[model samples]
Target: EYRLTNPPKPPATVEVMDGENRKHTLQVQVLGAEETWHTPSLLLASVGSSGGKVVFSQIRTLDPTEDVKQYGSTLNRNKICDIAFYQKVHLEVDPGQYESEETKFQALQKSDKARLEILQDLLSSHLGLSVAEKQGPLPAYTPGYFLGRHELKLDFLSALQPRLKADNILKLNLLSLQFCGKGVEPSKPTASLMPVFLHACPQRFSTVEYFENLHSEHIGRLLIFSEVMTSSMEGLDGAVLHHGLAVVACQQISGAGRSGNAWLSPEGCGMFSLQLHIRSDSYLGHHVPFLQHVVSLAVVLAICSQAGHEDVDLHLKWPNDIYVGDCIKVGGLVVKTIVDNTMTVCNIGVGMNLDNNVPTTCINALLRELKLAPLSLEKFLALVFTKLEKLLVTLEKGSSGVDQVRQLYYKYWLHSNCEVTVIGPQGSKQEVTILGIDDFGFLQVLAKDGCAFSVHPDGNSFDMLRGLIAPKVK
Candidate 1:
C-alpha cells in the first residue's frame, strides 16, 4: 500500500563487517514500532546474496512519514490497511537461503546497506531530477535584489505556445537552458543563500529557457513578475481577464492563509499565485477540492525531485496542506474562482519554505535536509508544471480520469486511515478515522464505534489533523 505518511521502522537486527572476518548485530531506534497497518509494507524478493555481504540492515531511512510512535495507542494500533493498492511495495529483499521462516525473517538484516543504496537511488530518480537543463548559476542575493524589477514580468499569452514537438527523453543544454541533461551538476555545499533566490532558486523566467533547452508540446503561459506590490492572484484577477497565470512573486509578500490569517511570506519563499481556466461544466468544478489535491501533489513531487525524496519529511496533509514531519508545515494551496460570463478562472496561491524563508516554529525547511542537493527556482517550477500538465490531461478524461487522479491522491495521502477530529452532522466535534476519499472528494471516515461516515468540505472543514470543522472555521 502507499503509506507515504508512515515513518521508517527499525529492523530487528543489523549485520556488520569487522576488521577481521567478523559479524555483529546492532539495534537501531528507527522510528515507528508499529505493525502492518501503521506503516508501509515491504515486499520480500529473494536475491542470492550470502549472509556475510550485508552491513546497515536494521533501520530503514524515510520514504516518508510522521513517526507513528509519537501518537501512540491511537484508535487502530498497528492497523494493517485492507484497502487494495493503497499499500505499495516500498522495499524488497531476498531472505538469503534461510531454512526457517524465523531465520528468513532475521535474514532481512543481511542486506541493509545494499538495500539503502537501492532505495536512495529510487528516491532520487523518482523525486529529485529535473526535465531539461539547469538554469544559469544562481547569484548571491543583494538586499534590494527584487525590490523593483518590473522588466522581468513576462508578456501574457492568450494561448499555449508549444516549444518542442517530440515524445522522448530530453537532453538539456546546461550552458544555456536550465532543464537540460541531468540538471546543473550538484553545486558544492553552501552555508548561506542569496536573499531573493534561496534554495539555489533560478532567475525569474526559467520557463522560457526550458523551451530553449528541450522541445515538447505547448503549455500555459506563466507571467513571472520578479516582485510584486500585492498578491499575484490580485494582480492576475484584478486586471480585466487574461489567458494565462502569474507567479505571485518570484518572492511574495503580504499573502493570506486559508484562515484569512497573514501568511509569513518573506523573500525566498516560493510564493506564487496561478490563474487557471476551468470549463463551465468542468470536472474541476464538481471536484473543487481536487484542485487542491492536484496542486499539493504537484508541489510535493516537485519538492521530492529537488529535495531528494527522503531528504525532507514531506507530507500531503489531507485537503490542502503540505507538511514536513508532523508539526512543521512546508507548503500549501489556496484557490479562488472568478466567473467571467461563461468562463471560470480558478486562482491558485501556493507557498513553500525555501532555505531561510522558513518559519522559526511550526514549520520545517527543505534546506535542512543537509545531504540532498538544493533546487533552483527554475528547476522547481519546471518539475511542478511538467507533472501538473500531465495530471491535468489525465483529469480531463472524465470519470475514469477522475479515478486515476484520486488514486494518485490516495497513494500520497498524509494519514490515509489515521484518526482525526471531524464535526458530525449535528455540528459537534467527533473523532473519525479517514477510511479514504470518495468520488466527489468527500472523506470516508470511520468513527470509534466502527460506524462509517462521510465528511464533505462544503459545509465542513475536513483535515487529517482535525477531523471536520464548520466551513467558516477553515
Candidate 2:
C-alpha cells in the first residue's frame, strides 16, 4: 500500500524533446510511496517506444476493506515502475440504439395488467364485490347483486341495453340497482331492481337517451337506479310512478354544455324531480349541486317515512338553498315537480359547498383557509349518497331525521364562529356574529345590541360582510 507517513526524496529536473525538435523541461518529486509528477511544457517524445499506460491489479487475498488499501499500493507500484509509459492511442465511439417498438409494447402491457390487478384487489378488499365471466351475449342484463357487509346493491349490464345503445356503447356499461316504494317517501322496501345505468367504457355516451330510458317504464313496472334500489313493491298502486320523485344528473363528455338547473313541486305534496346538464370541462363546478340535491331529497323522504309524519312541511329554496336554522339560511334544498293528468314527475335538488376553496360573494371566507385538496366529484357523490341513505333509514324509524342532518352539516360549517355583515334590501346592512345554523336552514346572527335575527334566502338583501378589521375594546 501507499504509506502516507514516509516518502522518498525528489529527483533532479529532466529535459524532453518532440519529433519537431521542440524542447521542454519536467520535474519529479518522490516522497516514499507518495510520488508527485509534474510536467512544465514537456513535449511528446516517441523515443521509439509506447507512450504510457496505467493498469490496476486486484488483491485476491485481502478483505473488502483491505482491497482499497491494495489499490493504493498498485497505484504506487505503477508510479515507481513507470508502468504508465506503455499506453496506446485514444479512439472515439458512437451512442447506443433507441428502445424497440416491441419492447415498449410489452412493457406497456405489463404495466396495464399490474394496474388491473391492483383495481381488482381494491374492489375485493374495500368494496367487497366480485366479478364473474359474462354469461351470455352482448347487452346482457344481469340481475342485481348485493355487496357484502355493506348491503349495497349493484347490477351488471352489457353495452346492448336500450339506454346503453341509445347512449352508444363505446365502453362497458353497468346498471345501478335502485329501490322504489309507495309515494315519494323511500321508507318501505318496494322491489329490488336495476334502473340507473353506469358506463365504464372508454367512450362517452348521450345524456338525453339515458334520461328518456329512465322515464320510460311498462305499466305496473317500477324502476330502480343504482344505489337507490328498494326491496319491496307491496301496496304500490303505480300512481307513485306518475306522482313520485325522479333525479336526473348528467355530465357531458364533450361538446358545449356547462350549466345545471333543477325544479321542485309547488308544495311538499306534488311530484319531485331533478335535472342536470354538465359540459365537458365544467362538470367540476356542477357536480356537488347535482349530488347534494339527490341526496337531500332521499334523506327527507327517508325521514318522513320513519317519523310517520303524513303532513310534511317542506319547500325547496331556489339556487341551491335549504330552509332551516330559525328561519335563517342554514342549508339549501330544491325540488322539481312535473304533473299532468296522465303522469307526474318529481325531481329534487340539493347543494351545499361542504368544503369549498374558492371565494364567492355570499359564501364565507373561511373556505379559503382550509388546506384540503379538491375533492373527487365521483367519490364524494358516492359517499354522500351512501351516508344519506343510511341517515334516511334511521329517520324512517321515527327518529329525529332533521336533527341528524343538521348535526352532520354543522360539523362541516366553515363560518360557524365569525363576524359577518348582512346586506338587506334598499341598501340596508347589519353586522352580526354567527351562532350556528338552526333546524330550518337559516342564518342566526347576533347583532351589536346582542339581539338575534333570522335571515331568509329571498329577502331584499343577503350578502356576507368580510375583510373588515375589528375595533379594539376600550
Candidate with top TM-score is 1
TM-score each candidate.
0.52, 0.29
lDDT of 2 by residue, 384-432 (tens): 3444545434433333654565555554344566787665444355777
Q: Per-residue lDDT tens digits of candidate 1, residues 1-474?
A: 235344434355556664233666554332222254454233221223432222222334323223344444452433422221223433555454353677655766676555555566443543343233323433332211111122322222112113311321111221111111123242221112112221233355454554342221322343434443344444444433333444445544346767576776666676776667766676775565667778888777666644345555677766677777665677777877766555667778877775444343222234543555556555565566667767777888888988887777766666666777764555566777778777656668888898997776556664434333444543
Q: State each model's C-alpha RMSD to the native.
A: 21.7, 26.2
Q: Give each model's whole-structure lDDT.
A: 0.51, 0.32
Q: How many backbone overlaps does candidate 2 show?
A: 64
Would you give me the overall lDDT of model 1?
0.51
Error of 1 at 120 (Å): 45
